[model samples]
Target: MEFSPIRILGIDPGLRTTGFGVIEAQGQSRVYVASGCIRSGEGSLPERLHVLLKGVREVCDHYRPQQAAIEQVFVNVNPQSTLLLGQARGAAISALVLAGLPVAEYTALQVKQAVVGNGHAAKEQVSHMVQRLLSLNGEPQADAADALACALAHASHATGGLATVGMKSRRGRWVSL
Candidate 1:
């Protein structure tokens, strides 16, 4: 039996708002499926993480994605905020892993470059490119758009190059380019 790579769930993790998007990868073509955000309003860090985990799990179960693509955590000027973001990311990862799903993480630069041909592209630029590439009519929120971009980047690389898709380090960890 042959399996089709049609469903993908992309996640942009944050302490406050975690964005999610589902996409379909058919052969060389990728299409938008759905996009939304998991908002964790003013709350404690642990509470926010709980919301992220639950929200991500619900999205995964609902979409039944073949694979999951998540954005890697980046540095922030505020150390506290950065730590909180990392926790949110960890929670998201845990949700996927617990659900027995394969995960690929992409850096902000890699996502921007894959979507807009520029590693340093602005959020709006990347969002616009995602909307254009996927032929989305209206504007998608920055986080949702970024999640879609992450899925497209994975699909593009998954079809073409191994390094682009993801590579396993000697330590047996998957790392995106």
Candidate 2:
């Protein structure tokens, strides 16, 4: 069997610092292309959202990814904070859609399980696993690592990597088989 390479962009949206990672998934291989953070420095809510929107658009233009994956926002104890994060996520998704890329969303638990074999994996564990999976020389920053994990999760789901590893998707979620 053969498969064409797919360039994927992943985003971890935040009000202050949004992280982005690019990867190429070909068959069973996942190659790291780039990763970085877009710091939406001190600013008003709208201003910060604008920065995130613009930054994500630029990343899409520069990387020319065919697909995108983003972390789904979880409800925080603070309603206001959750709302703000949702807005940031919306900005990122808007950029991806405007760029004509198919976007996928994954929960933090799903990403952790796909990348580190543990749904409850710690941030450090996720970072280490991402470094190993992508053959990165050093551990990426926390945000970038998370974005990479999201991309990896999508790649697994898209390329049947999960099934090869004794996992299966059921009802829009991955279940270990």
Candidate 3:
């Protein structure tokens, strides 16, 4: 059977740096489109947020992705840091929404497990797996790799219902969410 390709955009949002990746997925195949980071330079909180929002909107406009997946904010030891990150995420989400794209949220654990087959996988592991899976020429930066992983996970879930296809032994049991 033939399958039409779906374009996906994934975002890893941070107060200082936001990462974004775009990919086209068809069946079990994934083709990378672009990946990069948006730096919110030294500025006031509102100004930084404006940077993030505009950056995300520009990416969406350029890529014209059909779907978007974003890494969910995890609570940090510093509540203030977490809150700031959440604001950044809100900015990113706002851009996606304004672009009329459906947004899906995935936790870091979920992204790591889907991409690297381990929930506790380190950033390097996630990067390595993302490069291997996407057949990237070189390892992407940490944040960009994470965004790619998030897109890959969404592809895995949206394409063939393969979220549980090869995960039985990885976690020693069938895992489906």
Candidate 4:
């Protein structure tokens, strides 16, 4: 079989700051390319969303990732906060779509489980694990680390049917939700 590297972009979307990470995978080996957070100044919702969209598009343009994955927005204590977060996610997805990238969605639980071996993993745990997994010089910021974890999860999902595909392993191992 021919071998080709799969480049993936992972996004953690937020109203004030949107984090993005890129990775290249070939076979079981994965390499981190770049990661950063796009911060939007104090502004209205529309303006913030616009900033997020532009940042995402710029990352897509620069990295040229073949695929993209984003963290799913979960409900917050405040309904308004949840709604705003969802809107930010929508803006991020729209930017990826406009760039013609196939986007995959994964929940925060999945990302945490994949990276830190627990659904209730803390942010610091994620940052530490992401640094080890990607062989980074140091732990990334929380947002960027979360984005990198999303990319790592997508790489794993593509290689094996852990969550998205729901396929069984040769040893008949299954991922418990």
Q: Deviation in angstroms for 150 in model 4?
A: 0.5
| Cα RMSDs, all models | 3.9, 2.3, 3.3, 3.7
For model 3, how does the per-residue alpha-carbon lDDT over 97-141 read when each residue is reduced to its tens digit?
999999988888778877888888989999999999999999998
What is candidate 1's lDDT per residue for 88-160, written digit by digit as tens?
9999999999878899988877777677877788998988898888888987998899889888877766666
Over 73-175, each residue of candidate 2 has an lDDT whose tens digit, in order, gives 9889999999999999999999899999999888888888888888889999999999999999999999999999999999988898754577665644577
lDDT of 1 at 98: 82
Reference-based TM-score, model 3:
0.92
Q: Model 4, range 84-173, lDDT digits (tens) per residue?
A: 889999999999999999999888888887777787888999999999888999988878888899998888888663455645323212
- Would you list the C-alpha lDDT of every candidate in the order shown? 0.83, 0.91, 0.90, 0.86
Q: Which regions of candidate 3 deviate over 4 angstroms?
A: 161-177
Off by over 4 Å in 4: 164-177
Descending-TM-score candidate ranking: 2, 3, 4, 1
Poorest lDDT segment (10 consecutive residues) of candidate 1? 165-174
By how many angstroms RMSD does model 4 differ from the true structure?
A: 3.7
Candidate 2: residue 166 lDDT (0-100): 79
Identify the candidate with maximal lDDT: 2
Model 2 TM-score, all chains together: 0.93
